[model samples]
Target: MLSVNNIAKKLNLKVAAGNKGLEKQIKNIDISRPALEIAGYFSHYSSDRVQILGMTEISFFERMLVDEEREDRSKRLCRKETPCIIVTRDLHAPLELIEACNQNNIPLLLTETNTTNFFSQLSSYLEKELAPETNLHGVLVDVYGIGVMITGESGVGKSETALELVKNGHRLVADDNVEIKEVSNNVLMGSAPELIRNLLEIRGLGIINVMTLFGAGCILEEKRVMLNVNLELWDANKTYDRIGLEHKMVKILNSEVEQRTIPIRPGRSLAGIIEVAAMNYRLQHMGYDAALEFNGRLNNQIQKNGGLNNDF
Candidate 1:
């Protein structure tokens, strides 16, 4: 984990004689550029995690404070200690701002890059590092409450299958791009991105509204995945499962869900097969073990026939 302590130690190792700035002590950073107003907004809280992004191009930010005496409310909001303040774009710090920051012990970061790019990189890194392990994907749905995600080589009838499924009575969660988030432990929430919400595209049909064509019952905003049916083109020489024995799992967040691969071939109804697969998954979850039962019956028959080995 990258932390303020680590950054501080790195700074200590860098400058042989230079003093550490107030910005060096912050553990969590919030970036707000070209505005000191945010300092007044959340600055009252001593524990607040804030990083002010200052414009180095502006000279008006050099305002000074004659007396550090603060109001009673301000005193209560901010402790004697303050958070770090950062000035961007290699701008020179006015003596007043420097004095104020030094008095408050707020670390100041002065950099040479433009404010926009600096804040952008800071926010981007923090968000990526802190975000949950869910992904943004497109989901294919059907009438049987099956949450099938249509994914394959780009142009492989994924969205087309989903459009047909929706027309037949199933709902559409997200088209083109789906937003997946982990709200609680063990649960993965799936939703559609705003740009392509409730929309699906077919080769010849063009853009179509799932809700408008299929009615309200055919569109869903979000649903937890019960099974993952990977759609692959049918390979003539490739062996496929004739019986459900080996269990496949897809990991989402910290949880593992079941998976299956279905081959898409000419004259085959992929949407129907996907629905059936989902139904089979539900049945298995309800304590049905077809392979185990079949094996038990086979063993019993062998023993009854007096032809089984001693191991049986």
Candidate 2:
């Protein structure tokens, strides 16, 4: 649960009144304006969110002063389970509102930012902090600015391949356990946990510090995952995509990413292959597809030859 005090500290909010209720938990990320509630409309009022009092709502309170209803309305608004109230644009809370908040033990926060800007920033922060996340047993690396996650069986040499890529100047984001967070609808950010930020574990070499040995250039704090590389032992019986015309994809957090299956065999430079794959993926984004071009040329040649098999 997120506390009102934590949100205030994160957003650098000033405490105006009711500091006692700063420990109140904010169970919902959605904030409330409460303009209608100030006008005595409580039919669809939601009280389980942070309430924002902007100039408009303050104006409504000012008009209510003539009717001698400001204090009563403010009391009614703060009577519910409202987590906290934020006065934006550096606006001072009305004396009656402050009294109501203090009377009900509802935290009152003040911020210099405008209402719209403050809401946008706060919503984004809450969205990321409350995003869904999962962990995968693999290695995430940044190759040529592309985030690639290497996954396979337990003994598929994921860590070794990541180490090789690090030696070749690629930065490692995470090793062994990659904590992935879905920041947005289609974006997944990969990072290592605090306990294993710069550590890499190889089978024979045990554990080693990639940041200390290869400097800061060989490690990344976090990266946006763009591709997945699955390494498997070479299986001659199964047919692989030799021409690369057909591509595969993997889904993570409801987002699909381009996936490549690399068969590991003796004398094969896995690091070089992975690096080239990253570059090729970037090329595909840049409107250049070698496999598609090759297929188109082959079709053109076959049509020119009247679809006849020319085997000399």
Candidate 3:
């Protein structure tokens, strides 16, 4: 559960009342506009969410003719489960609401951000912070602006290829272990653990800090993994996709990424192959497929010749 105090620190919110309740746990990502609750309706109130008292809600409360009714409604909105109350536009908190929040130990925060923008920002932060996450043993790098996750069995040279890519001006996101979070539907974000950030472990090379060796420009804090390249020792009996017509996908945390299995062999440039894969992925997105073009040309030539020749 994310705490109200953490949210305040992250968003730079100011405390107006109920400082004691800063430790309240925020379970819901949605924010609530307490317009109806302020008008004395609490039947369908979502007390689990953080409350937002914008200009409209504050103005409506001030227009209430009876003080006792206003106080009663304010008290009802400060239920125990309610995460906190945030007043946007730097509006003044009503005395009744402030007193009720203090009595109920519900925090009341204030922010100068517009209500709609703040709602969007807070919802996005909550979604990412509370998203489902998992860790994988791999190396993540940004090749030609595409996030590629290099995965394979132990001692398959994932780090060596990533280091080569880094030397060729690509950015390194993570090495050895990557933490992936499903922030939204079909979007998986990958990052390195805090302890291993910017640190890569290569066999017989010890641990090297990529940022220190290559500067900060070649390091990314996190990236959306767009491709997965799995490496393995070349097997003579295995059939590989030489035509690039097969579509492969790898699933991670409810999301799937374009996957490619590259067979490792001596004298082959893995870095160059992966770079071309990234460029090809961008081309495919832009409605151009080299494999499709080649197949179309082959068909055109065959059709012009009126069929295949038979040998006696």
lDDT scores of the candidates, listed in order: 0.60, 0.90, 0.92
**Against the correct fold, how does model 3 do in TM-score?**
0.95
Cα RMSD to native, each candidate?
13.7, 2.4, 2.1
TM-score of each: 0.56, 0.89, 0.95
Write candidate 1's Cα lDDT for 42-148 as tens digits: 45343445443455324433342223422322232223334444456666655445555554555555656577776676665554434464554556464476566
Question: Who is ahead in TM-score, 1 or 2?
Answer: 2
Error of 1 at 305 (Å): 3.5
Off by over 4 Å in 2: 63-68, 79-81, 308-312
lDDT of 3 by residue, 179-249 (tens): 99999998999999999999889999889999999999999999999999999999999999998888899
Error of 3 at 199 (Å): 0.6
**Candidates sorted on TM-score, descending:** 3, 2, 1
TM-score of 2: 0.89
Best model per lDDT: 3
Q: Which 10-residue span in candidate 3 carries the lowest summed lDDT?
A: 303-312
lDDT of 1 at 47: 48
Ranking by lDDT: 3, 2, 1
